[model samples]
Target: MNKRSPLDRHKQIRARLARRLFVVRGWLVLETVWRAAWPVGAMIGAYFALALLGIWEQAPAFVHLAVFGLVLLGGAGILWHRLRRAIWPGDADARRRLEESGGARHRPIDAVFDAPAMAAGASVLWRRHRDHMAETAQDLPVKAPRLSLVYEDPRALRAIVLLALFIGALYAGPDAGRRLFQALQPPFGDAPRTVVLDAWLTPPDYTGKSPIVLHGPITANKAHDEAAAPLSAPVGSMLVVRLNGGRQAPVLLAGEDDIPFDTVGTVDHRLEFALSDPDLSVLEIRQGGRSRALWPLALSPINRRASALSEPPLKVVGKPCG
Candidate 1:
């Protein structure tokens, strides 16, 4: 008998590997589908529970809502696929056995096939599955969702590390002060700042002579001068910035956007020009035909500073502020 050459052996090995890979791939898909079913079912239950509890507080806004919706849809599809396979009548042996077994005498395999009997069996199985899942999940503390670098792709890890180093240099280097460059931006783009030079500031509707008239209800008072140290209101409030230049007109600001208006003593010959407070920064300065264009202020400063002792705002700016 002629012995197989090295090439022949290699080709044979490759063929076996290919067959094994195919089998593994098939098994992986089946396992993934099977495992995903329980999670999907649990999510469905949780979704309903959340709805009942009216817990939409932390739910994502518009963009995240869409993303979560797609995720749920994908989960639903996986669950449906798994359910179909689990309940499918394709397995001839299983189907035969299911048919032969008398209803209530033994557990039903597919409820769709024999509704009444399957329903009873399903109730029992559902109860067991629910209890099992609950007991298992009880001890496992809820994990804060986070990106685990351990599972990250090598290339992505390298790129992120490189980017982070590049960012670090901007802060670590001598040119750190350059980070405050964003502060030079105009409060409103190309819009001249309106100097309210009136003695009696009348807000929209002109109901009161108060310098500020908040249209919205105050929701949360992280800090305030009011009697309630931290007054929280369901509705948001409006902050009226009283103008001093003969203009009594008050600049109405939504409380939601207003950071604690820190009195920065005096700056640029004005005691209260709404000096660039570190707590608040201008988001956008849109110009309009009206006398007073809204200066969209952000509660968190873009170039937020940090302290060794305190938890500072996540700094987007590269360097330390002077």
Candidate 2:
């Protein structure tokens, strides 16, 4: 009826509506993505805080939380698909949409133009009506008026705020920020243990010489002095060993010699045992029937002078190591 093509006019108006619908749908999707990120960010921030505080002794719950977050995000993605389907308009649906969105001028005129489009086949009057619709579509503005459908939602804005806050908190604390995504580990390691065992060898009256005293624990399969010095003594020297300290006692004493260390002297908070030799390895100490730890010691004769010597397994009698 007019200079402009009717078919193209119908198509143009439909395309504009579809484009607006698409934009609205895209906005919904973007909003969904934004909203989904909030809870996920909250969960992630919580994990960082917990890890920094060393609160994950039993099992880290973040794995489950992250899974839940992914599920929530997946739900949003699925909703996006549903929203798209709703936004897409069929031919009949487009007819109704055109009528509703006809605006002021076309609003006064009845929607006879879209009547043929709603049906499968065209009638004699269909061309005339379609042409009129084309003219009407041309008169309307290019920009559609359903912008309200595509505006950012308040919920989405709130979600963005929450996400931003969570992200900011993650970086605010250096201790927490550095610990994110790091493996959870125990805080403490084995503490350094210091056990001191001291011993002395005194010759019997027959081979009498002054007693030689060594102060220190035996370790590495050898009885050693505190300064790691050597001991020189003749054979058959009575070994008098005294292990000082409340925590370094031995349940059973052992050595290469396998000689018996007899209980000899006792003082306040001290017990003296006569050892056959100065070389011994502490097998284990049992407190209340529970075996504890074991260490090594080495001992042998030396010249009158003590010198740094090679370490060896000791053979000393039972001496109260404590």
Candidate 3:
């Protein structure tokens, strides 16, 4: 029986590395998609829910979210390709070490990674390396390594754990979760450095209202001294402004006789203010006198749509005076 040469053994190792490289790269992409896809989906779902719940139906907001999701995924693909190529399987030195774990006892696979399809014109140095491989071949009966150097990696369990939690929270109360999702968004302007505000604008149950949250409502660190959206309620109607996650002192604020905001709590302020007159009001969040945020309030007549026109056709009593 003819003995197969060391070249054959080296070739075999290279082939194995190539195959293993594919495995590693595929796993990386799978892991990245696994981690990125769901959160993106959750965010999009939450945004849709908020829109349906009458939070804000501006198309641009959803457009920005879609662009962001595509960008994240596109960049992930580019990074995955780059990372895969970083491992040069063609390097004979690397291949030898790879097989070394499989029982290539000596550094016999030195040029395994660098060797060309066939070693070109033989120099003394080249011949010496070749001769070493040839001699080493005698020891390798089948050149099959005892164990594969590469191990398979799967999706991260930690990410999966967090994903489960996020999903649970999302289902438990989508409206409540909407606030957190909002904060995760990129701030529009130069937002505050470290803090986040999760505010919920809950409509009064009498108004058949459910809770709607605005996460990262104040994304900009230095936000305008005004509310993002106007809070409108008819006279005698109630509005609940629940603020969470702020490093500021809270005070039961009264805005100059403009229907006092009888709020609750200090650190995390939950301002439950009632409407009386058809006047404007504001809810300001001030902490350390540095961070300040405002929420506008609009009061409507007790019967917003109720009018004399609805009571009875207008009376032409003016003619009697004439």
What number of clashing residue pairs does each candidate have, in the order they appear?
12, 12, 10
TM-score of each: 0.19, 0.28, 0.33
What local lDDT score does residue 142 receive in model 3, on the 0 to 100 scale? 25
Root-mean-square deviation of every model = 24.9, 19.7, 15.8
**Alpha-carbon error at 107 in model 2, in Å?**
10
Off by over 4 Å in 2: 1-4, 12-20, 28-177, 183-322
lDDT of 3 at 167: 62
Supply the global lDDT for candidate 1: 0.34
What is the Å distance of residue 285 in model 2 from its true position?
29
Candidate 2 structure quality by residue, lDDT tens digits, 268-299: 02224443454542332222232322333344
User: Candidate 1 at residue 40, lDDT?
Assistant: 59
Q: What order do candidates take by TM-score, descending?
A: 3, 2, 1
Q: Residue 6 in candidate 1 has what lDDT?
A: 46
Q: How accurate locally, in lDDT, is each candidate? A: 0.34, 0.42, 0.47
